[model samples]
Target: MSRTILEVTDLRKDYRQRRGLVSMLTGQGRVIPAVDGVSFYLRENETVGLVGESGCGKTTIGRTVLRLTDASSGRIVFDGRDITTLSRAELRPLRREMQMIFQDLDAGLNPEMRVRDILREALTVHERPSDAEIAGRVRELLEQVSLKDSKLANFPSELSGGEKRRVGIARVLAVRPRLIVADEPTSALDISIQAQVVNLLRDLQKNLGLTYLFISHDLPVVELVSQKVAVMYLGRIVEMGLAERIAHQPRHPYTGILWSSLADKQTTEVTRRVTNVAVERERRTWGVFDFEQPTSGCRFAPRCPLYKEKGRPAICTDPASEPQLRDVGHGHVVACHFA
Candidate 1:
């Protein structure tokens, strides 16, 4: 049995949006839950992919896991210890165990700093090593990330997109983190470069026994790296299971639409159905104003093709009858009523 290294229970992150001049004067703002009641666990040395559309709170979930942003309310347990309420002083030591790889290397890396300086600084912050050890460690990290020593003196601007990302990965590894929250690490790279980075990450995991919470909007990349997959929609997980099962035989309608949208051929019956639904809607874009925001019930029901095909069932719209995740079989869970 795999040991659970990280567990998130009923995690929620809400942002208070400024209403307007009128509401501001009235002292009222709306609370928007970016992540609402999400729960999952990651096993040691395993990769769990959190896949969702752009604005489905995937990135927020990562940030909250690392405590980069404060969660509204939830339990974040790391290594069997509750970290949700840990003070800054208490969390300082635990910081070395968790790290995050950002989606944009430009934003993550300090453009003003050279690669050597960046790596050296990260190492110094966590622990004190002798000068000789620091130098040897730097070389080892560069070799581990497959970057040449020549790039050490180069600034972020001087490196290619792929090289910058490699540097980002190297910096993360310098801390010897046990769990890495990789948020779309290859989204900015070319297709060929993306594959190289993905392979590098996989190899590193095998060699180092690292656990990863890989977050991405790209279905194929997620499938390539993940053993398990979670599909989120509108701040909630709609489906989750083994990576192959979720990819080829998704139980939720939203997952089907996402799979069909990325399909190379619409030959299968399910693919045909998803393709039709895709055509009906213009294109899925993330924003509060894109579709009617559901106050309750199934949040995806407003845009779900199955809900429409079923003549807009009352259960879908009723606020009192919120759907909970149920196991279909073999640990495959879906939140859909019709699934």
Candidate 2:
């Protein structure tokens, strides 16, 4: 197997609302727990999909991992180096190896700069490139993202939404980053354009050997490109397993509901098949998890459909010890109390 390129352990980031004079006087200051103890791994050339609803900490996790936003706590190990505490000067050289594709293309790109200038600036930031070399690299990066190098001379306004994002990607690729923190790469794209970008990313991963932390709320899109999938809810990964396995059999309720799009195969099948699958689980045990530093018994208890009167799931585990990810064969690792 390829070496692990990125490993995040108990990563957490909190966005706080500073108390205004009025709120501070009234004592209403609150810190939004955006990313609370989310963890996963991204191997070389592997795509790990992070899916959750808006405000579930998916994008915050991506931004924090790449250091676009400083993390509140937890370790971020990349390429065998701990970057969480590296000073600005120390982190400068390593910046070239890690890149990000922003959710808002125009927001990240300078409106004052043309496409060529945008790509060229990235090259200049890292080192002094000859004019000819800079121009050639710009053209190459544009082609890598399936855009004409001629578009390089155009302004951001001259391109479509998809094309603008492609340019943003081109600028990042121009730096030859080994790991990409892609924040909703296709969110602004139309359905047809979404597929094109997804396919382009898949192809680029194979060619460049790039590992990705693909952040999105769309389950189907995440399923298409990721080898492993982690479901996040209110800043915690409630379920994590192989993409295909988790798609087929989700051990967590949040996972089951969020997974309907990608893993609804058994769910949409004949009623008998679904009954047998759900009933067959009675013979086995599953693991369980309780989010630390919360105000309730289970964060999902408020919305869970199968939750019982006494606060236990109808078809779930209640293990007393911390759960371990165990293979149910076929590379599926479920973190439930019963398993």
Best by lDDT: 1
For model 2 the TM-score comes to 0.84
TM-score, every prediction: 0.92, 0.84
- Candidate 1 residue runs with Cα over 4 Å from true position: 19-27, 264-292
Query: 309 in model 1: Cα distance from truth in Å?
Result: 1.8
Clashes of 1: 0
- Span of 10 residues, lowest total lDDT, candidate 2: 270-279
lDDT of 2 by residue, 250-269 (tens): 77655765554233343445
Candidate 1 is scored at a TM of 0.92
Positional deviation of 262 in candidate 1, in angstroms? 1.0
Model 1 C-alpha lDDT per residue in residues 1-339, reported as the tens digit of each score: 879999999999997776798568868877778899999999999999999888889999999988888889999999999999898999999998999999887865888899999999988997999999999999999999999999999999999999999999999999999999999999999989999999999999999999999999888778889999999988889899999999878888888877777764545653454545443462354233343254568888766778777888999878888788999998899999899
Best prediction by TM-score: 1
